[model samples]
Target chain A: MRTSITRNRILTVLALAGFVVFLVYAQTNWDAYRLRILNLCAVYTIFAVTFNLIYGYTGQFSLGHAGFAAIGAYAAALLTMSPEQKAANFFLAPIIPLLRDVEWPFLPALLVGGTLAALASLLIGWPALRLRGDYLAIATLGFSEIIRVLFVNWQRITNGSLGLKGIPDHTNVYWSWGAALVTIFVVKRLVDSSYGRALRAVRDDEVAAQALGVRLFTHKMMAFMLSSFFVGVAGGLMANLISTIDPKVFMFFLTYQIVGITVMGGMSSLTGSLVAAVLYTVFLEVLRPIESPFDLGPLHIPGIPGMRMVLFSTLLLLVILFYRQGLFGQREFSWDGLLNTLARLHRRVTGLWGRTPPPSTVEKGEQ
Target chain B: MSRKKVLLVWLTLSLLLSLVAAGPVAGQEDEIVIGVYEPMTGPQAAGGELTMQGVYLAHEVRPEVLGRPIRLVLVDNRSDKAESATAVQRLIEQEGAVAIIGSYGSSNSMAGGEVAERAGVPVMGCSPTNPLVTEGKDYYFRACFIDPFQGRVMAKYAVEELGVEKVAIIQDVAQDYSVGLAAFFREAFIELTGDAKGIVAFTAYQTGDQDFTAQLASVMAKNPDAIYAPGYFGDGALLARQAREMGYQGYILGADAWEAPELIEIGGSAAEGILITSHYHPEAELSPASQPFVELFMEKYGERPSAFAALGYDAYMLVVDAIERAGTDDPKAIRDAMAETKDYEAVTGTITLDKNGDAVKDAVILKVEDGEFKYVGTVKP
Candidate 1:
């Protein structure tokens, strides 16, 4: 009981610290463009986390996340906009009477969009859940392409690849990070529950889990639907942030990027994914100024415009090659460990000055 | 322990102090920096590279603007709207660019325009023909006519000149330029023909798609007088080749983006007789301003300049002219000067900036013949 209480205290401290840091960063950089990118990062964090729930926790390999995202983006875009704008741009207004005339607010549109995406996942998951591993990956990849093709062709509904633009920019850091926080909290709680254990059991050995009274299909479908709902919400957020939604925006390449984030961050670790997302965006931003040619004295190297992609791909390849288990693997960063290190450093310095303290007492105090 | 702690605190304080000491310099002198943000990679790389070549060639000819050495900082936006905004911001905040010239695609230009407008930097577009790029934005400007005018001119060419009644449009739906042009063309064609249903069928394809068999099959079912496809040259060439292979003997109409050397290389014999609307033609024999540019371009590049190259050249000259007229590197002054541009004799033609910041110029119609794009005639817009 003492250990459990100490763990809860450490968790609470870490949560508060993280919130304070985030608030400081957001307030310091009040630029709309920077805030927009932060909001996008938050949306992506939600996507990567939910994607991790399926591909990492449940061991389901699917690449249709972006396709579902596109569905949600267009749905939310269509749902929230004034009917006159929809009629002018898309030509085919939503046929459902309730959806047709109603210009739903941003939050309701996002919720409804996520619900629609969840329904789509149910429709696709019913057939796709029967498949395993590589087959599932290929099926989902194909489904993403089909959705993109439909968005390109169904101009009447999706404006046929011209993309839905002029979307309201209601996606702020508060909304995005708030959703991200809730997603992390809920996903963490769900993963620690009995349902998570059953899902893990199925992932480890499906036949055995079935024999052990685990409802395999039900658990898998629930995980799939929940993951799709969060991903759909991320999509709605993304659409609002970019103020546009093109079919190309949800191409297979986007799925590849998300998969890359998951692999580089460690599949089963939420903290790892979060850290990786920040690192990836920061690295790309820092590398931009270096793309131009440097003017050192007596040497003028011309700029190579295509080198950015080369560097990114090469770095990604190196990470995959050396660290196949990912940078953090499955280990989550703990505040207790960080505090212990700080205490140890203090003790070392004090001991060097000829005054040694008891480590056990300090450890107990930290606990 | 106390000494070490004091030392650590002092070290951290010094580092912070040094960082603060390295803050803002007084003023930037010695170079006139201009930002060139375009899609140097991705599906639109070819167009972007050609446009860059045009801008680079302009600097090569005259490296000074207002008696100061011109420095062109090229930023690759990777053809993404979000990245375009970041690129523009970097140029404005980091590079201290006096003006920005970019963004071949309409969406990219529009995205960059927002950043430039917010930062109070003048953004001169190279080939983004969207009117909305400069509708109300005072800082945004372009060197080409808008899609509505270009689309209307092409529609007139298709209906009156080509004597086509029913036209089918196979557009790249992912491209804002293509979609906007297609919509305007449809509207103009219907109005010209006085029939609301003049178009037989309108199909769509995404960018980077190589196969057009499915779309072509559907389009062929409805036999129209002509097929209008306003897409990039790569996709347009493939579509032309496939359509011809499928025995489509209708007239094919394209936009300025289809006037590349690769179009002929890819489409081969199938590209013959394909007509496109453009702003520049090396063979037009315009004026004294164009003769030297065309001659120099052919001498340097071993081929005549495409519409994009000419437009890039015009964009740089226009910006330089604005700086010279304004007599300062201030973006607001340059923008004011740019707004007052009239009868600017460019290689493309005589350009006049209208109230909406679009160039009111003549449109050149070119037709491919014998593996080369031949100048047909100029239609005054």
Candidate 2:
């Protein structure tokens, strides 16, 4: 066990180094479009990880991710937009006097956005966390709608439905992926700490956890607030990368998409969330060409819009149907797990399937 | 021992498989690509489809310019703001499009505006009426009159013709176009009537709202002489039906977004007497270019073209004309020629783009009658 721990530590370092190399490669070589898509992947990774920290690990099925993101996006956009740009956008109603002229750089703006989102989460979690299961889901969903409506009605702050445009393009591979990495690290640390175990205990059994003196609401609030903070930062990154935002951008559909990805990734595994984010973002783009008109031999396939989404949803359904517990379940990726799986696959290819060690050997080894 | 960990393996496998299957396709060769980013799917799909019909019809009418066949690279913006910018970028970076034509929704155009501006490729909006779509962007141009102009026209028509004194405004607060048009119309109505309280009631609803009783009840309480609800066709039709069903006999006015035939079909009898400020009605063909387009549209699709389709057609033709006049398919050259466009006889009207890159043209008023939009008259800008 001690040797395996050291092995995992070494592999973790190697894996992180590998990620840095990949980021450098992508930054230097990828074009503007590819880089944008990659940056989107990073932003989405942050969303999935933060969501996983709450919904996956803490077992609170909160649907207010979109609402939190909206708060973050608006806060960052209002703070970062130049006075001239704000004036240009607020033709119908001038922005609130406080946010009109203020222009901070991207990093501080993102932090402020995240902090606001976190604060909003605290306010929401205080009341909504009293409910459990489906009620909680509905409450969060309503909260998301309320935020969207508020963004639309509060024209002075959010520019109403017109939204803000011309957000400076400050988000590159480094900013997005670096933020994503920070999110993953923070979430992993939180989920592995004593607070994380108490949260998980609440997930497993509220009665037992409460009897054992676990303060349910406080722990739940901790996870919810932290998750929302990262989600808010992700929203800021998205606004910066996309260079435009409106109230409609943070509709319930955004939350649904995140939920779908979290469900596809394991409901409990941080690595699963990371994998799901990359798959969701990259696969959407990769599958897009099928929608565009293209020629095949002597036949021409006219671009069929909406087909890609259909295919994507179909794939998602299949994944859910075949693997009910999600992709990673409660498992974490380690060097030994991967190496053992590879060796088993090699053995099955060359030798007998029965000769391969049973899958529980790793489970027992981990215990 | 639940195979939950297998989720990563399966996901990896599927992603790899898809990456291989969706191998990079070859790029087009020796053709001037005109990128089109419109919401081909999603909530605004109906408007996008109508605009695409016009773009397709225009392309069919003139397939080539400057001795090179025009290849359109169409990308679906999915009615999303972020996707709009990405679509624009993909068109410029990957497809090498010389120009772009798009986007029915003003917000979609607004999102795509900056990307095209940065990339130095021009985009021609088909029917996005919000002035901000082309307000400060040098690369953005449009084929239709802007919201401020149309709003003023509607306000004038209401006062001079309908003689509406007390008007209520119900706008889709979620849509930039609806919000801007409603605001402009309110300003003009107040200005024309010379009454501070010309707008008796102002209520709002989100887009895709199926019910409007809450909004309608409040507006009816004010008992306004007219209700100017300038939203998309789907929402407008539903609102019209609800208002009529609720026994509100006042005039119901809409803007260009209410031009779709679905408005009549959806609202049915209630849609009758619904008035709007529009660009082109099929029967009110303004120029010689109008008749053929209407005829061609009917022949091709066996249906009458909506006002948006006409604007879309004009946008495509304008781009092609600019390319021909510029004597090159270069994006910079095409942009220069586009700004200088004047008196271009288009299906909608004679379009002369102003210094702001907005079309200086005439607006038309249409009324839904007998399951069709009948042309009332034109409002010259």
Highest DockQ scorer: 2
> Over the full model, what C-alpha lDDT does candidate 1 score relative to the true structure?
0.80
Each model's lDDT comes to 0.80, 0.87
Best by TM-score: 2
Model 1 chain A: worst 10 consecutive residues (lDDT sum): A358-367
Candidate 1 stretches with Cα past 4 Å from truth are A1-4, A7-11, A14-18, A21-25, A28-33, A79-105, A296-298, A340-367, B1-32, B66-69, B130-138, B195-198, B204-224, B299-302, B327-330
lDDT of 1 by residue, A216-291 (tens): 8899899899888888888888877766566777888878878888787888778777877766665565555445
**Model 1, residue B13: what's the lDDT?**
51
Report i-RMS for every model.
7.8, 3.2
Candidate 1 lDDT, tens digit per residue, B1-381? 443354356435533432332232223477899889999988678789889878989989989987788888898988877678778877887678899999888777866776787679998898988655676578888988888888999999999899998899988877767877898999999999998777999888878899998988888888888999999899999999999999999998999889888899999999999999998887786546888998888888887787888889999999999999999999999999999999999888888998878888889899999998999998988
The reply for model 2, stretches above 4 Å from the true place, is: A1-4, A297-300, A345-367, B1-28, B208-223, B245-247
Compared with the true structure, what per-residue lDDT tens digits does model 2 show for residues B214-299? 99999899999999998888999999999999999999999887877789989999999999998888777677889888889999
Error of model 1, residue A77, in angstroms: 3.5
